[model samples]
Target chain A: MRLLTALGQDIRFQFRHGFYYAYLVLTILYILSLRLLPESLVYPALIIILFTDICALGFFFIGAIVLLERGQNLTQSLFVTPLRLHEYLLAKILSFLLLSIVSAFLIMLGGSVGGQDLLWFIFGAIFSALIYTLFGLVFAARARHVNDYFVKSLGIGLLISLPILAYLGLFDTPLFYIFPTRATLILLDTLGGDYALSEKLYSVANLLIWFTILSAWVYQRFDRYVRHPV
Target chain B: MIRVTKLHFAYGSNSKDTLNGLNFHIDSGEVFGFLGPSGAGKSTTQKILIGILNNYRGTVFVNGLDLQKLTSDFYESIGVAFETPNLYTKFTALENLDFFAQFYAGETRNPNELLEAVGLKDAANTRVSDFSKGMKVRLNFCRSLLNNPKLIFLDEPTAGLDPVNLRKMETLILAEKARGNTICITTHDMHVADTLCDRVAFIVDGEVSLIDSPRQLKLQHGERFVDVEYRDGDSLKTKSIPMDKLGSNDTFQDILKNHYMETIHSREASLEDVFVKTTGRSLQ
Candidate 1:
């Protein structure tokens, strides 16, 4: 219940800070691109847009919000509350993921992607959101300002997007499966009925394992951030 | 309600200690004040007690539990109001309060009532970004009391407030004391320390120089006399009479009986004066 309250507050804060509106605008843009672009280019555009915007955008989005909270010294108040770091992190991830989901769903819905693929798309979007949000926190903890935050986040963002190599045909080996973004790409590809069931299961399992590891890292990073905040 | 022993803290690996070997204890229901000049470790000490800074080498027992061992539950019983206003600027005053009030599973005060108490009733619906510094301070104070905490840590609680709001805040703090809540106030404002704190500790250079009740300190260091001002014809005359024998002193008696008295005031030292005398540093 407390988590829900915190989530509600976070969502409200995000909306008031223009994150919600930003997502709405992104959704409209995605819809327009799908409608205006050639059919053959639409799928690739959808993959790139969904992957980059939904999964990767959270790193910078959450970074911006964290920096704002730090500037206002709201984190000091939050640190003193009964709300633990995990609960706080969960609230942030869930809130930002809600925006990611909205954008992903609107794009996929407009693209006429449905059935099991849509469900996989939703799952992939959520996992990607969670991963990048946590990834953002690691850099946000060390960043002193928004400009520095974007710089650091951009570097980390590229590291997380290393899985894009598999999609671009630069690397096709199974070693790419280690990257969470690779899992997301595979999920999207499978959703489009281009991959076998066994491969889809492998991608889901790999993503889950990465999520578990990132979750632990995020928890510790958040703890350190709270204890000795920059 | 709070005890610290050999408290030592430094900001980084090679930095000097910000708080060095500090030791003090605050009794339950007591309004204890941590007084110091800027960079004197008053805020660092408060932050430790409030569980915001834990990288210190010390055993801090708040409400009978060691701070190092405390979980998030420790915050359920404590309230903290920072010197600067830390609030959601985009939210309305009431929304900010209500949102923070949800953090605790325990009972919380009504948001509207808390705002009204702080004289922010009219601005309940107004976004905090539009509030003045004084209004934001009051709203921050209101947020601290939301959980009805047993222990409250106020860092310069009355800073940026007008005289009227200062008085209101003092009343609210005293009321909290009356309700048996222990409060620890950190401030360089001598007037606030003298007015609200039952006992105050003077800190200098990350160490405690003196700790005593304000009244006791004043009486101990102040002159044991009363300054009597009276009108002699059209001119004013003043005499300092020893308080020990004022009732029997013939000169004092004669002056009281034969002179038109203007004012008689006890020669008591202000907290600021005692602070300077004790710590050799002003509370600037």
Candidate 2:
């Protein structure tokens, strides 16, 4: 009940500032521009932006929430209950993931084009958003301040995505199969069947494996790392 | 009922224990007080009991369950209010109560009724971040009772309030006792300890030096002399007579019978004096 109230407060805070709305409007404008480009590029660009936008927003918002809660001493009050660390982490993830998906879909709605298959887009978005939410929790657990989160989030995201980026940019190889985010991107692009059965299974399996590990790591480290000095 | 035996606890990698070989118990239906200074282990012990701190040595059993084991429904039966006023400052007083009120499985109580109990109904809608220290203290006090818990742990429960509010808090705590809850109060205010506690343990340097009722301890250590005052003709005089001889002494009886006796009473030691004597440290 308390977690729900806090999440409600977080939602209200999102609307209280003009900058929050501006950020959404700008993203919606970017999505509209993609619709005007070549038809061949629209699906791929939307797929990339879909996964990228959700992951970026997930990390950004979750990081800010964790750092701000610590600053406000809300973290201290939470532990006074029987609220296990895992429950607290789950509540935070769910609240942020719901907002991310809602806001992302809202932005995408302002534009006409989305993807080849709505089901594939929704699946890829939800799955990738969850993983990123867990990843952001792991990120925010260590970041003490918002600016530190900004610097460190870019560094960490780059560090994790580098293996695939380097393969794509420097070597020009098909090593997009290595990073989980790119795997999700490929899955989104292959929606409505332009790919083989085995390829689809492998793509989903790859994402599931990485998602499982990241989720476990989030649960294990979140409470164990951050706690009142009881 | 609560029982602790050979309880030893230490901070991370510290050479000495915060609490070293401490032992105590409280029977059912009694208000237990733990009095200690800032660095003493009062809060540490309460944390261990409330299942906040693990890695403890020895055993603690609260209401017959092992302290280390975390259970789903135990929260419904217990409540804790920390000394630091750990409240969500961004939420209003009503919202703060509403949030924490969800963890318990018991019947929910109205936040307005609870605020009224703590003298905070008018400020229910005001943001806690805007509240004064005393207002937060009242909110913290009210938060501890939201679940209508059977066992409540309060650290400095009456901190940062005016005298009238302090008295109201005292009455509120005793009222909880009337409802058959076992309360553990931790504070250095001997007056609070003396007034509210049925049995108080004077803890110092991580160990309980003495535990007893305030009246009993005062009787045990008080001076056995009564100050007797009387009016002799136009002059008033006072004298201290040994209480043991008051029954047989001729002059003591004559003063009480013949002259206008003003006042006569025995001196009783206060809880503060007992704390100072037993621990050799001032409660202040």
- DockQ values of all predictions: 0.70, 0.40
Identify the runs in model 1 with alpha carbons over 4 angstroms from their true place: A115-119, A170-175, A227-230
Per-residue lDDT tens digits for candidate 2, residues A1-230, read: 64665566556545452435766776767677776779776655665566566545677678887776776656756666656666777676666567667766765675555555666556666777777777778878778788888787777676555433432345434565656776566566665337666766776787889888988887766655566353
List residue ranges in candidate 2 displaced over 4 A: A1-49, A71-73, A80-84, A147-153, A163-178, A191-197, A227-230, B227-239, B245-265
lDDT of 1 by residue, B88-139 (tens): 9999999999899998989999999988888999999999999999999999
Worst 10 residues of 1 chain A by lDDT: A221-230
At residue A214, give the lDDT of candidate 1: 82
In angstroms, how far off is A147's CA in candidate 1? 0.9
Fraction of the true interface contacts (Cα pairs closer than 8 Å across chains) found in each model: 0.73, 0.40
Q: What is the alpha-carbon lDDT of model 1 when measured against the actual structure?
A: 0.86
Q: Which run of 10 residues does model 2 chain B get worst, by summed lDDT?
A: B67-76
> Pairs clashing in candidate 2?
A2-B99
Q: What is the lDDT of residue A175 in candidate 2?
A: 62
